[model samples]
Target: MTNHQETIKQLIEQIGILSRKQEAFKYEIFELKNKLDQLQSSIDASDNVEKATLDQTDYVVKSEPIASGHREWIDSNVHDEATIKQPSFQHHKNQNSKVTHNTPQKSKKLSPFRKSNLEKFIGENLLNKMGILILVIGIGIGAKYSIENELISPLTRIVLGYLSAIGLLGFGIKLKKKYESYSAVLVSGAIVILYFITFFAYSFYELVPQTVAFAMMVLFTVFTIVASLNYNRQIIAHLGLVGAYAVPFLLSNDSGRVEVLFSYIAIINIGILIIAFKKYWKPLYYSAFGLTWLIYLSWFVMDYSNDSHFMLALSFLLLFYLTFYLTFLAYKLVKKEGFAATDIVMLLMNSFIFYGLGYAILNDNAIGEDYLGLFTLGNAVIHFIVAAIIYKKQLSDKKLFYLATALVLAFISIAIPVQLDGNWVTLLWTAQAALLFWLGTSKKISIYEKLSYPLIALAFISLIHDWSYNYDSYYHLEDNLITPLLNTSFLTSILFTTAIGFIVFLQRKGDFISSLKEGSTWLKIVSYAVPILFVFSLYYSFRLEIEAYWNQLFSLSELENKSISDYVVTVNDYSLRDFKIVWVINYTLLFLGVIGYLNYKKIKNIVLENSILVLTIISVVVFLTQGLYALSELRDAYIEPSIYYNRGSFYLIIRYISFAFLGFSILSLYRYIKKDDIHKGFKIAYDIILHITIVWVVSSELIHWLDLAGARDSYKLGLSILWGCLFFPFNRFRYFKE
Candidate 1:
């Protein structure tokens, strides 16, 4: 009995253990099945590739056979469930990897947040703005239809327009608490409507007086401004400001009420200036500025007259100028805000517009034309004082200070041309340029240096103008009574060239050039351009001076003997040509000499180097043309003179001076070519030309002397003799070898 009881207890305990193991396996199988379902759903939800791969995958779970005796003891339901859920785990893992690795292409899906935001923009912002625009247009069209068809009386039409505007404004205000952006669009539409209504009331219907309509529109502008501020909407403010400015023009009846119109614009400006100072709204400030000027400019263009409206126009200009001037600088002066590029640009535009308008008005009136310079100078002084104050107070960034300084210089530069004409302008510009350059180097202010460039350019340009003017005035030699080098124009040219040369000298002598970075554009300009300009200016002035001196002599001769023959006139003309040839050749030789010196000093310059090569080609042309003509002149003057030709020692000197300079130029050019790294072919060609030129000059001179000695018929004999003398020595010494 005891043995049988113990056996029963052991069987019961084993059964309990088996039951607990089966329950735990059941929970594990349930969790695995849940994971498989999630994985399958994700694969379906993925892009096309994964879906196609998943569609081909098999999802069967295989069951493993347990020990035969244990399988019989386990519950059939639990066994079936485990078999159904357990085998899919390994297969799905392998298949998942295959699907991932073999997936073809990915399609980017938009995130939920961005997609919703885009929908909101289309629905709220875009649709609302477009709807408001359409509504405004519809109102305008409806009013036009009613006016044309007599659908409503004019007074009633105006009343209904005001009512509609009031309704929209009130609705916008009510919606401001929840729908601020939408409210702004509606409010802007209402402001436009109000502007049209008020304008139509006064101009079209004639139901309201100008003063009353103006007062109503002013009220509307104030209301829009206050509502925009309360709503904190910039779009609303921009529309309100634009409509307010447009009202005056829309209500125009050609009455030309200058005082009223200006007073209204002035009031609007003052209010806008206040708004700009308060809100720091740059767009508002810019809109007001642009619109105000546009209206004022339109009025000035159409209706202004110096006789009737000078004081009124001037007073209003001053008002507007001071208004915007203070508005532009308010942040810096009052709040000590940092200056930005927009501030600088707006301030400059304001200054320029005021000056431009003021200048036009003054010149048109003719009473204050001379004061234009002082007016410009006054602007400079004011700007300079402003810059000084800013610098003294340290109210803003240094850029503003620099801007003010630049404006001062700009105004001063402009004042020069406005006040003076002819060489006075050029002389003053050169002086200013020199002063600026000196200040630049001494004070180490690069703005001064850069500013000097344009001043010098203007000086050079004005000097050219002076030359043209002088040319036109003194076209005839008899009319040229001024001294050669003592006149205003020539002296100014000299001073201009001298100033530029001095600037270049200082740049080289001081640390300025070395301070610049290598290959800088300014460095290249200073190194090459400045010196070239100086040389050119000097050459041009001297060439003209020499020509003038010759002309002076001819003119005096003409005055003494006014009844001379045309032959003598021709002789005098050729004499002038002779002097010109001498001058050109001598100057060219000097230029070549300077180039050679620079090359010898190893001062490498691309321009000067290329100039030498170019000069070689140009010299060939000048020699063939001018040189041969001069030789012809020498023959004509000495050997075969015209009947009225006046023979003198001057003819001999002119004839020989060119050949001497040509000889020196050849030597200078030869040295340059030898020192330079030129092609051997070029050198050989140069040598050939050199020998030809030498033969030409020597043979020509020989023929001229033979002609002078009454041997004109034996020119071939003389040429043969010269050729034999020249080439015999060249062949013997082998001097022509490359």
Candidate 2:
């Protein structure tokens, strides 16, 4: 029993030791479980923190777990009333990390104003619309107050105006920062107000010294341009331009301070030009163009007595026009849009303005009219140089190049007429037509071709003018035909005729008629009339030559005393025996007929052939009858008295030879027409003309034979009887048979 008891004691000891060891292991397991729970809670809180950052809302810091003993300490120390306000160590550490991550985000959210959609809408859309209206109203109110009140001192008004402008400017700056859309209007309004204030201060009230006023005006202009560039606004530029131009007019007490006004304009335009280089504000440029020109025109029309106004006007005109030109150029460059029709039109307008202003300035300055040509020439040279520059730059725009060329040509055209008088002008015009024709046809340049027509017309008109009215200086009654033929007027006529003929030839060669095939009938008629005009000019030139020769040969001094009309009428003689003019006309008709027939054969033109045939027949009959009358006159002058005395053998020989030649010509023409395939109407007309010529030749020969046989009295009676008998047979057999 004692042994069993001792063993029991050992077992009890062993049980106590095992129980203690189990208790220690249980505490460790409990601690590990607590650690696992704390780790899981931290992971969940981390997920929540990530979700909170994404949502941009609440964040929580998870507390760490502690042992039971430490828990009691923490609960007592951290959760006590006084210590609860203070963060626990772990809580403080987590809170600092959370703040470090979120501080930047919070600051970013608060940096800008959180404007509502409605506020944004009003700021962007409504401000500019209302701003312009308010600006106009403000200007009207200011102007009305200044004009009507007279109560406020000028200095007070000036100060008030400046303050108002400054206020607007500051307001614009504030709006620019907060609401960008309203800034442009506010700033532009300020500029306009400032300009008007400066004008009133300087001109109307003398509130500021002249120098100070000028400086203020310049400052305002600069500010305006700056605002225009910044806001890309044209309204500011327009307002500033108007103020600049109107200042002079508004302040004009009739004491034309012309230089001062122009100086102000020049300075303002310089600012505008600087702005234009950066922005393409068309309204600004257009306003400047109109206002500047209008002011200058007003000054010109009023005839300001100040001699200095002329130079100032000229300088300002150039400045205003060039500034606008540069503005257009800038627009083209910035937009990358190619040259447009409007650009060409603007160029042309600038040219015209330059011309008008130049003329006015030169005329006002008492520059001689002769110098006007020099001015025009200089203008042309400037255009040529510009064209050269454009070409050298290789712009590669055909229309622009053509426009520049056209301008150069136009200026040249004007300059020529201005520089030259009389035939020199006509010669130059004719040459211009030739050059245009060549360019149009050979170069295939349609513009030049169209230009040729007008130039040709001008040349013809000038030629006619020279023929009719420009003869007095170059012509004298005592001058021979050679002198008149060699005169400038005559030479110009010849040149014009030759140039027209060549142009027509080129037109035919180039098939230009196909383009006109669909033209109106009047156009076709005009085409036919061109050849007729050529013929008429030749006829007139020949007639003048013949008349001059006749006056010289006949020693008809009285012919010099007669007017051109009376002389031409009285000198109309178709007598082959009296002068060579009738023979010359016959030869000319033959030459034209041959040419027309050849052309018809080559080109198959029926109108040409028919016209030539008709003209040839008519000319033969008219001249033949006139020759008969001329023979009668010669018989009376040198044959009739001699015949009475029985010495008219010379007249007999001459008359027979003329009749024989007429018979031969009639026979030849009849044979040619009958064989050739001509128009039916022309054929009938030619047959009749040939029969009449036959009868006239035969009857005249019969009468001459009767007169030579000493039956002179019977000659007249026999001639009439014979003509009566032959006319019936000739017409019945030749014309009626056909």
Candidate 3:
């Protein structure tokens, strides 16, 4: 009897272990099914390539999960984003539209990795450590002396600096040749010592102008000459060694008053020649000038602008800058064989970035108020010299452009106040709006490339400060809302700019909506939304008044007198209630629509797209409801909460909904784009959303399970994000996987 009982107990234990194994297997199978669903979705997305447009899958840069960076281009105001489908010219013809759609190619191709010698050395991580060590030790001595007596002779200073640099460079060569190239970093210390000496000398002693210019020429010439002497890597290493010393010498002339800044120019041209002749010097020597030009002008502007009061001196300097930049650019423009539409855009953008830099630098009044006057004259003079180059395109355009842009701005900044009799800040946005439309129609440029952010920024600023604040500050529903309505009209007009930009680009390409088979769903949607967001105020004119009144009352004067205040208070209360009802109504309707759509799907596998979309709508509902609740507190009972109207949240309803929707949408669309591959799209989109949700919860701190300071409690709700990930694999087998 005892033996039989023991046998039964052992058998039971074995069965229990097997049962546990079975359950574990089931769990893994569920997870794997979810993964498979996601994989299927990716496959579907690939099948739906409209043209190789955003199919630049490599550019998606998977460095880290995006909380925000450049990728947050899907926001409402992202006018420059690739939101429209530019079809082929053939499609334009097929559409037979009466409009002359002449959209230029979309984006410029980034230059390939053309590594110069400097890049090679950096990439190889050559002799870095040794270079750093030598540099540091040299610095210690200089600092010691600087602290001790604060005095060092020019000749002694030069000698010590050179010795430190040579020592570091020599050690770098030895270590790098025998062991690892990274050893050269030791020379970083020596380079530091080199900079210290040159900096102190330049800062304190105003070396005679002739001597300084002569020294700069000599330094530039010597480094290039030295690099030319040897093709050996060590010799070239020595080339970079002195180039570091010569780097600071470039800045010695920044009084900006150098009417003949030609001395440095002459020296750099000579250095460039030496580099061209000397194979080894080409990279290292070129690097010195490259480093100087990239940073020197921008950095030295403050110093020179502060010192130079002479307008002609500044004018001459700008002349030289524009002259050289154009000469180099002109050579490339002429010589670079075939000119594609893309190449033209690149050339234009490069010129624009440089030209517009003057706008930012104009903020410097240290150069005196007449700097603009000087810039205008000097800029026009250069354009005349280069008119032949731009003549084919009626390129008499440079001066024409500069003068027109500046003068129009003058009308905005100066003439407007006088014209309006100083009572109102005239709406410059209308002019911007008008210009945007005309430019889009006239200029044969692509939307993604041609649309400039500055105009959009101006419109948004007006939306925030001018329209919103004007209503709240002065006019009210109680007083009059015509002022606010007018502002909204202007605001809507300006926001229509992106669409106009799109239309213009489409007209330019002549193939606007031809790629329907491959265009992005989101882009199509935003195309519709931009117009709506632009005219949002028009849709709810009364609501805008409610908003303006509530904001002004809450912020400025709460209930003031009895009768008037009571009426204001009453209007505000009604508005806040509407805000909450709007949230519930919008979200509930959205939820029902999604469910109904999902139920109508012929198969469960196809439901990923709808499911993700519904979740997004729901998330927005939660986010905005909370927002309306917060805003309701701003004013007394009379003021309504402006949930989506005005007020800011880093994790606001729109942002949360947009991201959640986008992530899921992309995943879902990708998985189920193909009928047979439906399950895959849903799975991938679902999994990623889960991943996204988890990340949002943790990073955003949306949940309040843990105490948070400020609005950080937004993350407390983030815990719900796991729904995205969990649902994908758990219900995998049910997805359409044909």
Model 1 CA lDDT for position 569: 24
- On the 0 to 100 scale, the lDDT of residue 723 in model 2 is 77
TM-score of each candidate? 0.73, 0.68, 0.36
Task: List runs of model 3 lying over 4 Å from the truth.
Answer: 1-262, 270-295, 298-313, 337-361, 366-444, 447-461, 476-511, 514-517, 520-525, 531-537, 540-542, 545-738
What's the best-to-worst order under lDDT? 1, 2, 3
Tens digits of per-residue lDDT, candidate 3, 561-635, equal 346546533222344443444434344434434433453463252233455454554554453355334433322
Off by over 4 Å in 1: 1-116, 119-207, 250-253, 332-345, 434-450, 471-479, 506-527, 559-573, 598-610, 613-625, 631-635, 639-646, 653-659, 673-682, 735-738
Q: How high is the CA lDDT of each candidate model?
A: 0.73, 0.62, 0.43
lDDT of 1 by residue, 1-738 (tens): 454455556656555455546644544444454345444533534542334543332232222111112223235534543442221112233443443536656556545767877998999899999998998899889989999999999999999999998898789878975577798889888888988888888887799997788778878888878876766566777776876776677766678788988898888878876775675666777887888888789879988888999899889988888888877777666644556677878888999999999999988877889799988998899899989988888656666787889899899999998987888889888999999888877787777777888888888899899987884455365556677778877787789889988987786673664334579987777677777888789878877777666656555544223345533322344555665665665766666766656755775655666677567557755865686676567557665555555666666666576766676667766775785576666577667778788788777777777767888789998899889888787786465553
**Count of backbone clashes for each model?**
0, 0, 65
Once model 2 is optimally superposed onto the true structure by TM-score, how far is the C-alpha of residue 634 displaced, in angstroms?
4.8
* Model 2 C-alpha lDDT per residue in residues 640-667, reported as the tens digit of each score: 4531123345544556556555554454
User: Which order, best to worst by TM-score?
Assistant: 1, 2, 3
Tell how far residue 82 is off in model 3, in angstroms.
Answer: 62
